[model samples]
Target chain A: MRQFTATYKLFLQHQITKGRLTLISVMAAIAVLLGFIIGSSGGDTREGAVVLIMGYGINFGVPIIALVLASSSFGQLKEDETLVYLWLKPSSRIATVVAAWFAALSAVIPAVAIPLTITSLVASSFDFSLAGPTFLAISLAVVAYSAVFSFVGLVLKKALIWGFVYIFIWELLIGNLAPGTSKLAIKTYPTSILINMTDEDINGDLTGFFVSTPAAIITLVAITCASIALTAWRLQETEVA
Target chain B: MTQQPPPPSSSQQAEAWPPKDSTIVARSLSKSFRGGLVALSELSVAIGPGVTALLGPNGAGKSTFMRLLCGLTKATTGDIWVAGGNPRKDAAVRGRIGLVPQQDGIFERQQVYDFVYLAAVLHNVDDPQSATLRALELVELNPQELTRPLGSFSKGMRQRAKIAQAIVHDPDVIVLDEPLNGLDPKQRRHMIALFHSLGEQGKTILVSSHILEEVERFGSHIVVLSKGRLAAEGDFRSIRSLMDHQPRKVKIACDKPKNVAARLIESSSIASCTLHDEETFEITTADAGAFRKEIAIACQKSDSLLSEVTPLDEDLESVFRYLVGER
Candidate 1:
């Protein structure tokens, strides 16, 4: 337990550096600013919100932010060669792996959530109903993205570049039109949750793409567990010093 | 002083290398990386309690072997045991082995105290704060300096901070890979003293270095490595003798070098001489100490003033080559 907390605290410090905090703040403000511009422009506010939410948030902004933050959890440590300080200890590898996953969350949640909330609300022309779905969707997205990226960070070299490819090519572009690959897409879960909860009038490319809420939740939860397990196993096998 | 045992054969190494009271043992260890780079070959040796130096030239697999000992890397073959447990297989065994790595990658944003304290907590020490204080004190880092971030420290202080973190948990076996780098002479002396004290406490402390003289100061016991293999192990004297008795080139700077070279050519110790200019010359000597005594006498006879005398082949690579060749 102490080891877990120690790893958690250190990883949190890594995430909340002044430079990164400023970068995340800028990204959040820009996302909100884009949402506000479309909402007040008077051309179908709900559709604009969906474009920003599904197009930018789900497909681009959230995953990219989560990728930089999550992958850096172990990536930066290994690059700096400081991983040996933690790796040579007697503590359980899962403790460190689990703690790193949560610490990435500790910053990732707040960094991605508030902007998403303000973006949806203002973009929906002060629709308070948008808050519930926005929060739930972003919450699920960040947790799932953070776990997968953390494992990717551990196993893959140049993981940030590879993660970018996965998000841009596989998740957004291919998952949009191809139903077979879309079944494997992570964004489908959160997007389905938003479509089901936000508004019955919410319709577009998402009309035929929605999975049931329970199924979506179960898949995301399963991915998080599986990613964490793989990370722990790789942690033991890695030759770090 | 421990006497040199006969060089053990590959088959005999298992029985003859590390004796009964070995604290760390590696048998037939080999590690290879991509591109066919073999860092450590089929080398085997055992180290017991005390400050035994891990001596080798750069790229002699000292760091690789140390990483293997600390469980930071897996062995390509064979086995290694620290305190009767394999650190790679047993997480609990890592608590007993503390490592001071050579890489300069400490937490730069963190204060020295916090870094060492983190190591203490991770090792599950009973009281991290107290252990941290004791470790910092042992390394002689000032209390006021503890609050400063590690990035702001000079190289020497950073080295001390690294030493503090390694000792914070008071592990039974400590592996230091090139720990003396960046330290000034005074800090080096203090560090040697601290290692001596740790050795007296019956801890197995292995300090690795490429420089022969640096290893000599830590203690007479040394495991000399060359090209990923054990070249020699035992007392420092045997190795020192081999280094001293080699035919080495000595350069002398003096007024009237030609006359002095003429006088020195009479002696049997001077195997050959090359007069470079009006005031300088070089000699290849079969007997270094005898040549030193003869040069002064020859200079006086020729009425020449001697300015300097320096050895040319004193680099560690050559010494390692000599050892490897001799063995």
Candidate 2:
């Protein structure tokens, strides 16, 4: 526990700068503003917000926020050779990986959840059906994306560049090209959670991406656990400078 | 033609390579990088407790050897045992080893207390706060400096901070690579004293340095490396005696260069002499030890005010080359 606190505090200190906070805040404002515009139009406001979230939130916002913060957690540590300081210790490597994962989650959760909450409120005008499912989808997406990106941060140099490529090529492009391939995309699970939980008739565009709730939840858990375990393995196997 | 001796077998290496109450041992250790640059090759050594200096030129694999021992890098081929356990395989064994790495990659934004405290926690120190304070105090860093960010401190202060963190956990083995690189004279003395003290307390402290004179203060036990291979290892005077047989280039600046040169060659020490100026001359000697002793007496006899006697190839790097060539 002491090991986790020390690693967690130090890793968190490197992130959470004024600039990142401002950027995340700006992204949230954009999500809320567009959701409000859809709300004022007065036609299927809940369904409209879900569509906006599915397009803007699931496809872009959640992944981007996760990418920036989670990847930098370990990526910057490697870039600067500070990883050696952390790597030399007697503490379990899993604790360090999980601490970094949690440190990233500490910021990612608020960064992701607050904006999504506001946008859902602005779009649905205080309805649980819209806000609740929207929150669930993003919350699940945050867990999966943070774990995967944290692993990416540990394994690759210029992690953000690779992260952006994966976002574009795998999640956005390849994800939509085939229904079968969508099962592999990280964003697809949240897309499923959002579509299957909400009014299916209203989300005609996203209705095709829906998988069963059990499958989506199971996949997200599998991805998060696998990412954490793989990260620990990498920390053990690779040589530190 | 003279026959070159065969390479020592692994068993022979265990007995011969400074096996003074041996604790850290590397057998048949070799490491090659991606681009075919071999960092360490067929290196074998046994370093026991005390202040043993690792001498080599830059790119001579001193840092690489240290990294492999600390389990920071994987050896291409070899087995290393630290404190009766291979640090690479035994994560618990790493708790007993500390490293002051060559690269200065510490978290510079954190205050000194935070930095050392993190190391203590990672090492599972019983009371991290007291341990951190004791470490900082040992390195002579004042209480007031604890709150300052590491980047804000001077080079000497930063070096002490690095040392403090390495020693914070009080491990059995401490590996320091060029540990005194940035310290001032006083700080270097303090650090050297601290290392000697640690060594006295039964801690194995392996220090690395390229400067011959700087390392001379680190006691007599030494290990010399050339191009990733063990050139020589033993008492300092023993290695010096081996090197004494090599021809040395010596330069003298004095009042009577000709007279000094004339008296210096009387004992067959000088192979040849060349006078560069009225006050300066150079000589190549078959026996450096003989010439070193003869030069001062020769200068005094000639009634010359001895200004300087400099050995052109006396640097540790040059010494390694000379030793490697002779072997």
Candidate 3:
């Protein structure tokens, strides 16, 4: 338990010192501003709804932030050669990975979720009841994306490039162009959650392609579990060098 | 020092420590990379209490052996046990052993105290704050410096901090890979003293260094590796004795080089002597002291001036060359 606390503290220290918190804050502020401008702009209520909908679409920021944050956690271990220190500890590999993941997730949650909730309320001028589900969906999406990207970061040396390709080429491109590939992309499932949260009557066309909320929720849970398991396996098997 | 019985044969030594009782034991360990690069082959060693220096030159398989022992990489074929258990399966083994890696690994943005405290936590040390403080004090790091960022530290301070982290948990064994690589002479002296104290406390410390002199300072037992094989292993004097018969070089600048050479040759102490210019001769002697005395007597008899007499092959560089052959 002490080891876990120490590892977590180190993770937090690394995140704070690396300017991750500051970066997250800046991104969230930009996201909030973008949400407000798009929400208030003159358009049909349905079009204005898509604009207001962009706040919940903060799931888009989830993979980007997670990819950047998660990819370097273990790579930094390798670069510093501090993996030996961690490896020599009495804690299990799974525990170390989980501790790091939880620490990073905790730091990023406030960074991503707080701005999202604030922006959603400010931009739409929406009631708490209307924003609640969207907030929950975005929060879940952040955790799911963090887990998946953290796994990628732990396993690959070129995780940043690979993460970029995953988000841009696979999630954005193939996810839109093909239905099968969309199921494989974490973004597609979270986007479905946002589609459910938006006023379906006002924006039927935009939400048409998304799966049901229950199915999206199931996918998110499954992917989160799978990502954590894969990450644990990688953490155990991978050599420090 | 009273000599213990000759160390058990490699195989017997491997099995002597109860698999469940030894701090570390490796038997017939071998590892090879792709492209047929054998990093270690049939390497066997057991490490217990006190400091053991893994002495070797560059590319002598020290790093590979360390990685194998720590279970950072799987040996191609062998068995390794740490604290009476397989390290690969037991995370607890890591807690029992502390490693100070060769690289400077502190996070640039982290305060020194936080960095070491984290290591204590990782090792599951109770009361991490005090443990961290104690570790810092052990390394003799100033208390004020603890709050400062590690990036602001000088190279020597960073090295000390690295040592602090490794011992923070107070593990039974600490492995330091080139722990004194870049320190100035004073820092090196401090580290040597620190290692000696650690050893006196009965902590098993394995320090790897290419510099023989540095290893000689702290290592009670030494293991030498050359080109991925165990070149020699034991006390320094025992290893030194392996090259006992190697020709020792003597440089003499005397008034009568021919007379000195002749006396040395007559005594059968010198294998060969080559006169250089008028006053100097380089003699290869089997027994340097005997040849020196013989030359002294001959010079006195001839009333010849003996300007300089020096043993050219008495230092470590010559000893290493004689033992391992010049690269």
Candidate 4:
């Protein structure tokens, strides 16, 4: 527990800063303003808000924030050669991986969740129901995205670029367009969960990405656990600089 | 060539692990990296408590050996025991071994105090805050400098911070790879004193350096590696003597150089003698001390003044050259 606290504190300091915090807040405002614009421009305010949440929040904001935070968790340390200090510690390898994962999750969660939830609320014209489900979906997405990206950060050198590619090509492109390939993209699972839990149809866009709640939960949990384990195993076996 | 560790006595076997005499022991250790690169090969050594210099040129496997001892990388073959148990398999054993690597891998954005404190926390020190302060103090880092980001620190200050982190936990064994690199002369002297003080406390310190003079300042004990092999071990003087086939060159200044050369050539210890000028003679001998004494006696008998006798090939540089074949 002490090891986790120390690593978490240190890793968090690397992530959270005045500029980053302000940028996240701005992203949140952008989401809210976009939803308001889409609503006041033409159609139902609730529908417009739900469309912005699914379009900008889930498809863009959440994954981008997760990628940045998760990749920075281990990638920065590895690049700086400071990973040796953490690797030489008496803490269990699992603890190290999990601490990094949690730190990334903590950073991305706020940066992503508040913006996403506020966008949903403002888009829906202060409807609590839409905001609540968006919050749940954002929470679930952050966990899966943080774990998978953290694993990539540990395993790859240019994790940030690869993370962006995965977000653009796999999550946004294949996840929405290709029918069966959505299973390979982490964004699909959280989108499926949000669709199943919420009433906002948003032009029936969520129907194509729908999966059973149990399957979505099981897949997310599996990806998170497996990625964390693989990261810990790699750290144990590899000779880091 | 491999040298077996001294067999443990009955009392030692019956007592606890580590055998008390040895702090680090590697048996037939070897490491092969990817792409068919073998960094270390079939090397065996036992290191006791004190300052032992690890001397080798680039790609000599010094860094690999240190990493193996610290459990950062596992050996491809054989085994290693650091501070009593296997650091590779046991976290407890790793806690007792501190390593200051050669690379500049510091958390540059972190404050000096936070960086050292994080190390203390990772080592599971009893009181991390106090231990951090003490470690910084030991490294002689000013109290005001503790809060500044490490990126702002000069190279010497960064080196001291690295040393502070390594010694923060007060481990039983400390492996420092080129710890003296990039330090000013005064800082170098201070670090040498610090290493000597740590050794005096019975802590095993294995420091590697490219500077022979600095290594000499540390101690006489050294482990020399060449081409991923243990070329020589023990005091440099003994190793130099072991390589007796190499001729020792000595320059002598005397009043009658031709007379001295003629008389010195008759001695069995003198391999060859050449008269350089009127008052100087260059003599190559298998034994320098005996030849010096013989020259003194010969000059006394002949009424010739012997001014100076300098042994040209007795320092660590010559010994290292002979072992590594750099000469």
Root-mean-square deviation of every model: 6.2, 5.3, 5.0, 4.0
What are the per-residue Cα lDDT tens digits for candidate 2 across B165-207? 9999999999998899889999899999999999999999999
DockQ of each: 0.62, 0.71, 0.59, 0.71
Q: Residue A58 deviation, candidate 2, in Å? A: 1.5
Question: Candidate 3, overall lDDT?
Answer: 0.73
* Residue B138, candidate 2: alpha-carbon lDDT: 97
Better of 2 and 4 by TM-score: 4
lDDT of 3 by residue, A89-170 (tens): 6677677777777877887777776777667665655445446655676777877887887788777778878988888887
Poorest 10 consecutive residues by lDDT, candidate 2 chain B: B1-10
True contacts kept of each: 0.90, 0.82, 0.84, 0.78
Best by lDDT: 1
| Model 3, runs deviating above 4 Å | A17-22, A43-59, A199-208, B1-23, B249-261, B273-283, B286-317
Candidate 4 lDDT at A238 equals: 64
Using DockQ as the yardstick, the better of models 2 and 4 is 4
For residues A1-241, what per-residue lDDT tens digits would candidate 4 score against the true structure? 8878989988887767676677677787788779777756755777777667777887888887887778778888888877888888788999988998999888898788877887777666777887777888888889988898888888888998999898998888888775588888887777777777776665464466678778988999999999999999988876767
Compute the TM-score of each model's chain A versus the native chain A and list the values. Answer: 0.94, 0.95, 0.87, 0.93
lDDT of 1 by residue, A48-166 (tens): 78668877788877898899899988988898899998899888988899999999988888888778888988887977887888889988999999999999998888999999999
Q: Candidates sorted by DockQ, descending order?
A: 4, 2, 1, 3
* Residue A195 C-alpha lDDT in model 2: 79
Off by over 4 Å in 4: A17-26, A177-179, A202-208, B1-20, B253-255, B266-269, B272-280, B287-297, B305-308
